[model samples]
Each structure stands twice: as C-alpha cells, then as structure tokens.
Target: MIYVITIAIYLIGLVIIGFFKAKQIKTQSDFSVAGRALTPWVLVGTMLATWMGTGSILGNAGKTYQTGMAGLWLPLGSVLGIIILTQIAGKVRSYNKFTVPEIIGERYGQVARLLSVIALVLAYMVIVSYQYNAGGAVLHTIFTDDSGVSAISVETGTIIAAVFIILYTMLAGLLSVVYTDVANGIIILISFMIAIPIFLVEAGGFDGMQIAFSEMGKPEHMRFFGVYSFIDIINFCLPGFLLIMGDANMYQRFFC
Candidate 1:
C-alpha cells in the first residue's frame, strides 16, 4: 500500500511535469530535442538514466550473481565506450541535424540514410519491447501478493507501462524525458544509498562476503575473471559496449 502510494505520487509528479512542459513546445525541434536547450546537469541526468536502464541494473546484476566478477565486462565496456564518445560528442552536436537520418543523408547519400532509418526503427522497436517488459516485470513484482499471486498479469502490466510511456512522450517530448530522467536518477541513487548498507550489513561485511561465498560453494565468484573464457568476455562486452557508442538516446542527448 505504501509502495503503491509512493509510486502514484511519483507518477503524478511526472504527469504534471509533462503537462507543464507541453505548453512550451511550439516547434518540432522543441518537441524532439527540447529546443536544444538542455543544461549540462539535465543532459548528464538524462544520459546517465538512459545508459543505466533495466539491462544495467537487473540483467547485468543477475549476470554478476551467476558469473561473479566477470559480469563487470559489459558495464565496463559501456563505460569505456562513453569515455570514448566524449571525444566525438562535440562533432555530433555540431552536425546539428534534427534526425540521425538527416545527418547520414547529408554525409552518405539517400540510400545510406534510408538504410539507417530502417535499422534505427527495427532496433528501437526491439529496445522498446524490452523496456516495456522490464517495466511490466517490476510492476508485477510490486503488485504480487504475499503468496506470489500477481494482481496484474505481465501482459497487462506491460500494456499499462507502454501507454504511460507513449502518453508522456507525446505530451512533453524531450522536455518531459529529460526532467523525469533527472528525477529518476535521483530516486535510483537514493535507493542504492539506502539499500546497499542494509544489504552489506545483512550479508556481513568484507569478511562476511568471503564466508557467504564459501557457503554458496562458488568461491570463484569473487574472482575477477571468474569462470569466463576469453571468448565469453569479448562476446559479453562487445554488444552493449558498441551499442552505447551509437545509441539514439545518447546521440539525441548530445545533440541537445
């Protein structure tokens, strides 16, 4: 009940932000890129939020649980990619096109632009599907009964999440996206700040980690290259790492 109330309040706040920002969006550029006026802090917040999604949290964390320390490869790769992106980020922003296709068309020709758009749509649709699924899973977990009966099915939860996302995107465009991203980042940071200490205390401290690992019978989980072949490491790191370098969201934020 408390959780639901908190979520309700948070959502209400987002809606308000969207409705407020919607009034200011008079041009296509304003809607698509927040008039290219996002401040550094807001840009940082959105970029961080975009980069750290359910994949970074639950998916990679699960991998870490299974493979121990080897799971760091994916996120480490992403971080390294971001560091590299800093080099060309200025170039991206200076190109000053509204859409990625426009930028490509200008440089590569119409055929390349068409291919890029097709690829972007296909890839983004897949990304949206996963995002909806992740939101649904979180909602289902939140609404599940003590006996583990879900109040809402995953499909229903997904639809609800998708609707909210669509509504917010239509309502305020990049303005709402960036503002809500900053808020989301703050909440996530606070959650980790509060939870990590409790988790550490529960699992016992540094010494306790060793004891816990020993009991789990997977002592190698604490190892840097735990159980991962060289091929596995490369394979795990490359996709996410490379993807971030060319992600639409990151590029959009840079353009802003």
Candidate 2:
C-alpha cells in the first residue's frame, strides 16, 4: 500500500505540474516549445529523462542480468552516439525549427520531410507502445500479491498509463513534459545514488559476485564478452547506435 501510495503521489505531482503549466499555454509556440525559454538545466534534465526510458531501466537492465558485464556494450553505442551528437548539437539548436522534419525539409525538400515524418511516426508509435507496456509491468509488479495475482490486470494498467500520457501531453504539450522530466531526472539520479551502494553491499561486491557466479557454474557471466561473440556485440550495438542517431525526441529537444 505504501508503494502504491508513493506512485500515486508522484503521478499526482505531475498532474499538478501539468495543470499549472497549461495556464501558460496561450499559443502554439508556448505549448510546443515552452516559448523557447527553457533554462540550460531544464534542457539537461529533459534530455536525460528523454533518453533514459524503459529501454535503459528495464530492457538493458534485464539484458545485463542475463549477459552480465557485456551488457554494458548495449548502452555504449548510445553513449558514443550522444558524444557524436554533441559535435552537432549547437548547429541543430541554431536551426530554431519546431521539429526534425522542419530542419530536414529546409535542407532537402518536401519529399524528404514527408519521409522523415512517416519514419518518425512509425518509430514513436512503437516507442510509446512499449512505454505503455513498461508502465503496465511496473504497476503489475507493484500490485501483485504474494500468491502472484495482481490486483489490476496489465491491460487495465496499460489503459490507465495510455490515458494519463495522452492527457498529460495534451494538457500543456512540451511545457508539461519538460517540467515533469526535470522531476523525473532528479528522482532517477537520487534513486541511483541510494540504490547502487545498497545493491553492491548486498551483493558483497565484485569479488563476491565472481565467486557466486563460479559456484553457480556461470563464471562466463563475469567476463567482458559474457559468452557473446564479437559479431553479436556489433549486432547488439549497431541498432541502438543508428536509432539514437536518428531519434526524433532528442532532435526535438535540441530544436527547443
């Protein structure tokens, strides 16, 4: 019940923020771009929250659980991509356009813009769907009884998540998203700060983990490659690299 309450409180705080921000949304530009007045720190927070989604917290974490240290390679591609993006971030921001397709349209043509829009729509739809699933999974985990039955079904949780996300986005557009993202970024940072040490201590540190893996007959789990071939690493990495490079969310933040 405490866990559920905490989740509810967090969501209620976001709703309150959205409500307040909506009052300031008098025009399309204000709603879409926060009137182009976001502080550097808010931009940092938004970027962190945008990039660190279900893929980072659940997908990559699960891969790491299975593959051990080699799972780090999965995110290394995105890290490298972000580094490359930094070189062009200033240029992207200077374009001062509303969206990635706008910049592409100016550079290429209407045909290219239409193609980019189609691609972005497809990609974002998939991202949002999985995000809803992730939200549902979170709720299921939180509400499941010791007997393994959940108070609410994953489908119901998914519907709730989808409704909240759609309504929140519609309320104040990017203004609400950026503000809530700042809060989320702080929460995530604080969670890592508190959890990592506790986790390491409970696991008895790297040497303990190594010994445990050896005893479990899974010593390969401690290795850098972790039973995966070089080709497998490349394959795991390339898609994330390419996706991050072309991610519309990150580019839209840059535009803001």
Candidate 3:
C-alpha cells in the first residue's frame, strides 16, 4: 500500500507538471531544445539524472551485490565521460546542433548523419525497453499478492510505464523531460542518502556487516579494487568511454 501510494504520488506529480507545460508548447525547437534557455545547474542536474536511470540504479546494484566494488567502475567510467565532455563543451555550444545527426552532418557528411541517426534510434529504443523492464520488476516486487490484478505481469507493467513515458515526453518534449530529470535527480540522491544509513544500522553496524558478509562468502566485497584484474576493468570501461567520446545526448546537454 505504501509503495502504491508512492507511485501514485509520483504519477500525479508528473501529470501536473505535464499539464502546465502543455500550454507553453509552440515549435519543434521548443520541443527539442527547450528554447535553449536551460541554465548550467539545470543542465548538470538533468544530465546526472538521465544518466543515472534504471540501468544505473538497479543494474549497478545487482552488479555490486554479485561482483563487489567492481560495480563502482561503471560510475567511474561515467565520471570520466563527463570530464571529457567538459573539454568539448564550448565547441558543442558553439555548433548549436539539436541532434547528433545534425552535428555529424556538419562535421562529416550526409552519410555520417544518416548512420548516426540509425545507431542512435536503435540504441535509444533498446535503452527504453530495458528501463521499462526495470520499472516492471520494481512494481511486481512492490504489489505482489496471491490475487488482486495478479500483481501486474512484468510485460503489462512495462507497457503501461512505457505509455506514460511516451505521453509525457510527447506532450512537452525536452523541456518537460529535462526539468523532471532535475527533480528526479534531487529525489533519488536524497532517497539513497537516507536509506543507506538506515539500512546499515538495521543490519547491525560495521562489525555485523562484516559477519554477514563473511557468512555470504564475500568478505572483500567492499574493497575498492576487489578481485577484478586491470584488463577486466579496461574491458568493462571501454564501451562507456567510446560512447562518451561522441554521445549526442551529452552534446545536447552541453548546448542547452
């Protein structure tokens, strides 16, 4: 019931935001770049929030649970991406391109633009699908019961979530998405800060945590390096590194 109430509150908040934003919609540029009036803080907040979506939270948690501190490498890779982005921030803003394809076309050619569009569309679709799956898993865990709506099948729940995303995104476009991301980032950070300590205390402090970890047969899980080799870390970080070098989303945020 608490979980349902929480979700309801979030949905209501999103609806209210979308409702007001609808009135301000006018053009494609307005939809795509939010009129290019976003402040730096807003840009940073949205960038952090969008990057730290379902994949970052759930996927990272699962990775950390199984592979220990090696999971931190993912966030580390993201941080590197941000740092590299900073170097090109001025260039991106100067170019003032809305989409990746536009930037690629300007720099390279028509072929580059077309190829970029194809790759971006395919990658984004896959990303959205994964996020839908993650949300469904959360809902299923929260609302499970022997009966009553059958606790919502993962596929059904995912479809519903995806529909909401589509509607909200389609309504106000980047303006709505960026502002919501900023707000969500704040909420997520606060939630983690509060939850982690409470959870640690309940689990009985550092000493108790050690004992439990030993029982689970993974005492060194908290170490920074853990058991991963240098080669393993490089392999894990490579995709993120390459993506960051030429990510359209990062460039958009830079320009915005």
TM-score of each: 0.97, 0.97, 0.92
Query: Which one wins on lDDT?
Result: 2
Which tens-of-lDDT digit does each residue in 137-237 have in candidate 1?
88888899899998888998888888877788889899888998999888888988999899889978867877789898978877786477888878888
Task: Report lDDT (CA) for all predictions.
Answer: 0.86, 0.89, 0.80
Q: Candidate 3's residue-wise lDDT over 128-183, tens digit each?
A: 78988887777777788755555778888788777777777888988888888888
Model 3 earns a TM-score of: 0.92
lDDT of 2 by residue, 142-250 (tens): 9999999999889988887887777778899999999999999999999999999998898889999999989998888788854778889889888888989999888
Which pairs in model 1 have colliding backbones? none
Candidate 2 CA-lDDT value: 0.89
